[model samples]
Target chain A: MTASTDPATKEPFERVVQAHGDVVWKVCRGLLPQHDAEDAWSETFLAAMRAWDRFDGDRVRGWLVTIAHRKALDVLRAGARVETREDGPPDRAVEPPGRDLDLWAALARLPAAQRAAVVHHHLAGLPHADVAALTGSTPAAVRKAASDGVRRLRALMTEEPR
Target chain B: MTESTPTEAAMPTVPATPPQRLEALHRRLEAAATGDDAPDVHYRHLDSAVGGLLVAATEQGVVRVAFAREGEDAVLQALADRVGPRVLRTPGRLDAAAAWLEAYLAGRRQPFPLALDTRLARGFRLSVLDRLREVPYGERVTYAQLAASADAPRAVRAVGTACATNPLPIVIPCHRVTRSDGSTGAYLGGAEVKVRLLELERTGRLPD
Candidate 1:
């Protein structure tokens, strides 16, 4: 049978996952802590795979990012009842150590809205409008949060010894 | 903020490198996509006497077997389109089918206990494939004979069509059917593969 004969078929879902995986992870990392980010990332993809048939293949990246945004929010909401350690250098010191600890530590210090704005727009390359929708803010607000987050991140990264 | 100015200049250099955890998370996502904990379609490439074949299976059984010429990516796309998009490259899930194919290609002729998903064919075409399985090993049947066995004697051409489009080719033994004039008809695995499979069954070894 000719490949074009089937209008019902779309590109394979695995390719979508492979292509957008890192971006989804970045979005999750921007919103949640490392462990929770990974969980959200996994949940985003698993949910995507389940709903893949109904998804419009043309906007795969945006759809995936939206799912990731929602999944990350779900993770944050679930953990809201639990008390996290206060945000400070000494408080950050107790986190399980790994490479880029400083980078993640800096990220962890930002207000949640600013962090999401920076991660979604800068790292994930999502439009300010999309980030705004995900974060429940306007595009202009998203831009400001990203700028403020970056300014704070610059301060935080420089304070840490190389 | 002057001390942080240098860091601000470098701030644009947020770790471009993805953390190791992302890769680990991707693997975990793939695992969960194809895990036995869920109902999902699993696929993988297999090397055979013919060439690379993309084999797919669901919880029901072996569903689609596609030759390399058809494109593994295309085959998977079709599966995603036709079947659920829950398909993933899960080699471990195909272990049973692989074992059966390995033994069969090694000239063992072991019957595959795996269930066949015939959703790819329907109506008379589906009946033709079902009839093809009883053709017996080391024996040949004409397209006309296959059609007659399916109780559609006038549909010899339809029988050939069914064989050509058989989703599960080698497993279904469509290679056992030939032209009424004793010529090898078209095969999804190509003519050379058809010849080699017939020779293997006839002489207990592939042709040199």
Candidate 2:
């Protein structure tokens, strides 16, 4: 009997995970705190793995970053009312001049629009048009938001680490 | 008021993000992917007495055990080419199989306890493997003897092909079969491995 091979083999899911894992994590971590970012990262991949066949894009990084954006936003909205005293230095802190800055903390302080723009356009390397489509803004607006967010982040990062 | 509020020169650099907890994250995603939507094939490496062996499994059971000679990457691609490409290197799923093989290789005359997926072999080859498994520990059987036992008395050449192509060789005990003149036959894992396996079974100890 001739044992036949599959006519079309799906690309292994592990490859997808390996290829986009870093960018996806960056997008999530840029928008949310460390623990929530970890959760968002996993959620993004689980959703991707489940809907692998339905994946319709050649731009895999864009797709994963979009999913990560959603998960991170979900955490923000879920905890908007309850004061989540996250474990670390306060969301806004000032300390010794030479101390390193907490990037996640700086990211957490940005307004939602700026945060999304920076995460999608800068960290995820998505074009401004894609970020605009994801965030309901125009490409020009996305570019402005990302630059403004970067300016604010640089300022906040000068204060303190913990 | 200004983009230069904290000049690039003055701003403290963000501490390097802690090393990613990728191993843990991978486990979580792999677990979720292996849900009702679709099952994934998981594989792991086992350093045995002979060499590094790759053991792969479907959700049902251990499917393929390949020697390092096969090239681990090529074996994985072949598995993906044949058995849908939803594969991951999740070692936790193969605990039972790993433990059993480790015990067997370490001179514990353990019965083959892991479930086997023999879907890779078909027809006469499948039957030959089935018959070969009953050749007890420390025993030897020529291809003709195994072919006869499988009730295909005239199919000695086919029997050799079956044993050579056996996907689960050491686990299926194809190492027990030899050539008609009592020479170690052509094994998929090489004849030297066959000799070593036979010695292990015969004396219950591996030679250095």
Candidate 3:
């Protein structure tokens, strides 16, 4: 919820805010609840501004989203640590009331890479080849990740206890 | 084979459900992303070192516009593949944008200098985007005011959607719309841009 300034590359810095800001917000939606999305999003770009010079311009969008993913993962880890310190890890939040909700919960259960692959493919309208490029995996690997993610989600949704 | 129980036999089959709605939403998003890149449309040369080709599109009727930069052929190719491949780089397609944005950056523009193509949207979303465009530069309107302006005051949340799903950000000036309590709501271009745009209009300095 705060803005940071990078002294050396001013406009290019703001331009990053302009260019890939949507991706940051959308990525936040996947990792955090709707209510926390904004907070996580702000943290992502604030971190990005401090690290902007290290970003390769050619792969800027992917770089931004990658950092956002790491930031969000850190938030999730922090939440987990808090839960462990208090009541020994969150269970209710991960398991939900209905099948549809459980599908999203299952998505959250994925290893971050698989989850990101699914998100980058289905929601982001990115092709498998481009997603593979972004994730630094081969296209075949991205396809497998997306398929596995979807398979796990489906299994969670159709489990008999529903 | 054992005789089937009547209750068990009465189960209905689950029909195959098409992913139609999801596909449609994807297409709409892709369309919103690619926009019109016909060379006939005007191209603004941003500071090249910034490293992207930027384009602004306006409704055929008026000239005011929003700016978006999709740099590198790889990303552009990706956008085009999803949205469409027909992109033109016409020189003056963005005349109104250049004028309005220049004035806006210079603290001379208010209430925008053009009309928007809500044709890019439909139904409730179109209504929301249209209302957002009415928001004046330098001044802020609450999401409630935006919904009220559209005559659906109860739909303040929908007003927020209009802002979130805005296809054209700067031109519609969704950044000018905020929470009633003055919190800058979630902005597509990040709250930093929102604050900077506001700061520019207010104190005449784009935040350092």
Largest TM-score belongs to which candidate?
2
Model 2 C-alpha lDDT per residue in residues B70-157, reported as the tens digit of each score: 8876787777667756667778888877887888877887655688888888899988988877888889999999888999899988
Candidate with best DockQ: 2
TM-score of chain B of 2: 0.86
Share of native C-alpha contacts between chains A and B (below 8 angstroms) recovered by candidate 1: 0.49
Which is the winner by lDDT between candidate 1 and candidate 3? 1
| 1 against 2, candidate with superior lDDT | 1
- Per-residue lDDT tens digits for candidate 3, residues B1-208, read 0112121122122122124522332233223323331211222443321122254343353221323332334333332333322222333455565566556656666736464444445788888876666666578899998888899989988778877866566667788888888788777656777777788778865665
Docking class of 2: acceptable
The TM-scores of all predictions, comma-separated, are 0.82, 0.83, 0.39
Query: Candidate 2, which segments miss by more than 4 Å at Cα?
Result: A1-7, A54-56, A81-101, B1-20, B30-38
Candidate 1, pairs of clashing residues: none
Tens-digit lDDT track of model 1 for B81-113: 777666777677788888777778778776567
lDDT of 3: 0.54
Error of 2 at A15 (Å): 2.3
User: How large is the i-RMS for each model, in angstroms?
Assistant: 5.4, 5.9, 15.8
lDDT of each residue in A1-162, candidate 2, tens digit only: 122233144566777887788778767777776567778888888777777655655677778887887887788788772312342553234222233235666766778788787777766777889999999899999978888888887787666454
Ranking according to TM-score, highest score first: 2, 1, 3
